[model samples]
Target: MIVRVIESDNELQQAFNVRMEVFVLEQKVSEDIEIDELEEEATHFIGYEDMTPIAASRLRFVEEYGKLERICILKDYRGKSHGKELIEAMEATISAKGYKKAKLNAQTHAEGFYQKLGYTTVSGEFLDAGIPHVTMIKEL
Candidate 1:
């Protein structure tokens, strides 16, 4: 998988499409909640296999950390390490931007995956977009 920082409207739309498939369609998250007001303020990323978008995520500087948000991989692409690649790319960008920490509200089912990537759960489970999630943080 090739992960790139989204730099064009077309690339951003591709990212949104992947998110729609994974989050809104498969997970049943509402479109209104999935695509929120923060879109304009976040730096988005899209991962591609050849020319096909497979994964998507976004980063926002919050306080002293880079906040990772809306991370997803298309259903067909799960378990292939594309998600990990996408995350590493985001983390690299966070560090490059001089942030010393990264944080995210990870869906409970995916908490273990984030742990293996060096994130530590810092908060109890909470509901977000009607799904269970916990806040996780990692030092860059």
Candidate 2:
């Protein structure tokens, strides 16, 4: 899979489109809420398999933390660890920006996946976009 970080509006559009397919279409998240204003200010990553985009994420510095948002992998690609690769890509991008830590709001079911990637649960479970979620963090 080709894991590419967004460097232009075209790349950012690809990343956002993948997120929409996985998060808005598949998961039923409101399309209106899927695209946040932060997209213009954050660093984004796009993961592609054989030149086809499948996973994507975004990173933004928030105070002392790097916030990871819009992380998602296409259903057919879920077990292949593309999601992990995407997160690792985001980590590299954020660390290159001099961030010390990374944070994400993960669906509760995905907490274990993030945990395996060295993220620790930092916030109690809660609802986000109608799905149970929890805040997780990892020190870079």
Candidate 3:
């Protein structure tokens, strides 16, 4: 398994497919917002298992708000290290971009994962894409 940032349309397509599988089909999130205006602008990271995309995320610098997002992973790949690898890649991308911190709105059930990766909960639980989530941040 090799994990890295998305650098081509092929990788980007794989990342999009992963998101569609998890968010749209498995989680039933709205397709309208799943691929929104922000996608084209956000930086993307992806993970491949034997050259097949299995996990991914997007990074967007919200200017004054900080670098936020990139929190999607494949269901079948979940208990493995793909999610963590994706986050680490995002952190590296943030650091390279000169961002002091990175943030993400994590699903409530996955709070522990982010926390383990050095993120701290900074917001109360809220519904996002029909699932409970909490905003979290971590220094780069």
Q: List TM-scores for all candidates, in order.
A: 0.98, 0.95, 0.93
Instruction: Summarize candidate 3's per-residue lDDT along 1-140 as a digit string, tens digits.
Output: 57777789988998899889989988899889888888888888778897778887888888633455646777777888778888888788788878888888999998998899999999999998789999999987
Summarize candidate 2's per-residue lDDT along 1-140 as a digit string, tens digits.
78887777888788888898999999999999999787788878888888888888888889889899888888898899788888888888888989989999999999999999999999998999999999999999
Compare candidates 1 and 3 on TM-score and give the better one.
1
The global Cα lDDT (0 to 1) of model 3 is 0.83
Say what the RMSD of model 3 is.
1.4
lDDT of each: 0.95, 0.88, 0.83
Q: Spell out the clash pairs found in candidate 1.
A: none
Segments in model 3 whose C-alpha atoms lie over 4 Å from true places? 64-70
lDDT per residue (tens digit) for residues 1-140 in model 1:
99999999999999999999989899999998899999999999999998999999999999999999999998888999998998999999999999999999999999999999999999999999899999999999
Best by TM-score: 1
Q: Which candidate has the highest lDDT of all?
A: 1
Q: Any idea how many clashes model 1 has?
A: 0
Give me the runs in candidate 1 sitting further than 4 Å from their true place. Answer: none
